[model samples]
Target: MNKAILIGRLTRDIDLKYTQGGMAIGRFTLAINRKMTREKKQEAERNNQPTADFIGCIAFGKTAETLSNYVGKGNQIGIEGHIQTGSYENKEGQRVYTTDVIVDGFTFIDSKNKNGGDSEVQDESYDGFYPTDNDDIPF
Candidate 1:
């Protein structure tokens, strides 16, 4: 049914733009970390490490503007979307294929107060641990 889900941190702030018809569009990259683990059959096979994969996503319409306004670099979010693919010719006449997710929905997953310094102060307004535009905290 062409559905995909991702939970990751934003690599940078969302880039907001408009189409020729004035529809808003936002683009961003997400960095998802995968924990690598090795199982040991003997006494020397236990190995664990962390790796990350970055992905591109796009959002359209009011959702796009909202995401751009509220989200920033390093914010963790959950995305639900579908995969889209396209191809284009470069200056050298080489064909380039691109793939990205067209986001349908998303949610904030990071704690209200990141960096672990002021959990209590941040939690005072942490409804679902997500900060709203109406919140008093400065972004």
Candidate 2:
């Protein structure tokens, strides 16, 4: 039950790449604001600290391709996924640990227009999970 749901803006464009075996992988950062009381807000302001957390995330296969093609920096989106953590030795002989959300589903949350006016742009979403039988998918 390691599910996580997040709604935030993309810190930068999706980094799409492929493995040697031709599997697609996309990496992106999400900036999520922190909920705070007035006192906490004032304290944060005084400390000159940001009130948002930047989270690293990744998507695979068709989901990665779709995201890389359609989304960019500052676009808001909702994603449902699971947290993954790992560690490795770096070239400097230091142990580096990492955490990321492995996205299973995502949906665009912002309109195409930056002016916030009404537009005809429809929402786009993608889900990565599929049934074991794969009977429902046409392709």
* Maximum-TM-score candidate: 2
| TM-score against native, each model | 0.72, 0.78
Expressed as tens digits, the lDDT of each residue in 1-139 for candidate 2 is: 8999999999988999999999999999999989999899889989998888999999999999999988788888999999999999999999999999999999988734566642334433324443365676689
lDDT of each: 0.83, 0.88
lDDT of predicted model 2: 0.88
Instruction: Return the clash pairs for model 2, or none.
Output: none
Question: What TM-score would you give candidate 2 relative to the actual structure?
Answer: 0.78
Q: What number of clashing residue pairs does each candidate have, in the order they appear?
A: 0, 0
lDDT, residue 84, candidate 1: 98
Off by over 4 Å in 1: 38-50, 111-139
What's the residue-level lDDT of 62 in candidate 2? 98
Error of 2 at 121 (Å): 4.6
